[model samples]
Target: MPNAPAADQRRLLDVQALDTRLDQLAHRRRTLPELARIAELESQLADLHTALVTSQTAVADLRRELAKAEADVQQVRDRAARNQARLDAGQGSAKDLQALQHELESLAKRQGDLEEVELEVMERLEAHEAALAEVTAAHTQLVDGKVQVESERDAAFAQIDAEVAGVQSERATAAAGLDAGLTALYDRLRGQLGGQGAAALRGRRCEGCRLELNPLDLDAIKAKPEDAVVRCEECGRILVLLPEDH
Candidate 1:
């Protein structure tokens, strides 16, 4: 059997591997592209809603103006009819009759002006209605896009979570099989080494820092006992040697 220190070193390496995988899963969850797209869609939707409200308000104001103008025209016509009846009944002096006729002519002109204003208001209402329709269409498209993106994002997160859960379960099992003292040492070293407590030495290189070992360091590691755990001088990471066959 390997010495206690060598066994602890192996367990630390396994823990490091699991930690790396956890970091990757966390990064994937945090930086999803679909989430950014969803934020953009929501902003556009809010702008569309504001534009729609403004356009509808304009339409309502135009309608109100048109109704008021039509009412004023009807009132002027009624006044003119009353003046005509008074003239036919011979109830006014000649000068008064002339004044009434002049007033009737002025009222007719005013009615024409009101009708022109009403027409202009109706044109504006039509333009606002057209703009509202366009905004509504755009809003609908964005809503549909948001729905699709949300569904895809949810599914992606769910899959990532499932993978993380499975890996965590396996890591727990591995931990259970390790010696208690070894596990404690690994946990302490992991905290001290910025989450990476162990590393593999491949081809005279430290995998953690990707740095090649100096001649002296190589000689020192070579002279160490087989079951004597050793650390990389440069990176302070437990360095595992390759098997004899590979």
Candidate 2:
């Protein structure tokens, strides 16, 4: 058995209380609601970014298609206009003039067909542009939401950190000047038993495990000298005996 001054044994209980508070604070930090919300927002942003890129690419490809269609229509119009001007000037023999008239008719038909293709490409391009705009707006909204959430999360972190620092200072003070051998034993047991190295023995109960000691065990513990360190059989934790009036 280990020995410690009874006063040091009582002070161990104070250290245990402070240590438990620190553990609780750490757990709170890990499980904060802001952390979960941030993760969810990040996932949504990733998927939205992919969609935004796809919309932009589609709009660019359609704009290039429309440009080609417009060029094709303009080329046919220019050719038809030149043919009509030559026919009006009457600068060729009858056979040549008749051939010119026939060629002008063919060019007019070609221009109409090219115009139809250009109209179709323009319509497709307009629809894609609208789609791209809508996607861009949605992406911007989500980005703003993420920034707001991040700010809130940062504020929460600052509050929790301040509390943790305060608790750590108190724990250090509580553990100071404690018996070296008892402190070592307590630290070792805490590492082994879920952050709880010592608990009070109230009446016939072992507070560490919340179990009632058998009469024989209770009497044996009571018979031990006050300075003799005692452990509970139920939980193997150091048990500090309190005064009856306490």
lDDT of 2 by residue, 1-246 (tens): 989998899999999998999899889889888789878988988998898899889889888988988888888788878878888999799888898899988988888888888898889889888988998898888888889988998888899899999988998998899999999999999999999999999988988999999989889888888898999998999999986713
- Count clashing residue pairs per candidate: 0, 0
TM-score of every candidate: 0.78, 0.88
Model 1 off-target regions past 4 Å? 1-5, 46-50, 77-102, 177-195, 225-228, 242-246
Could you give candidate 1's per-residue lDDT for residues 1-246 as a string of tens digits? 124445556666777798889879989999899999999999999988898888878878878887887788788879888987887786888999888889878888887887787788888878888888888888889999999999999999999999999889878866666656556655676788877777888878999889999977888887777666667888877677655402
Question: Which residue pairs clash in candidate 2?
Answer: none
Residue 46 C-alpha lDDT in model 1? 92
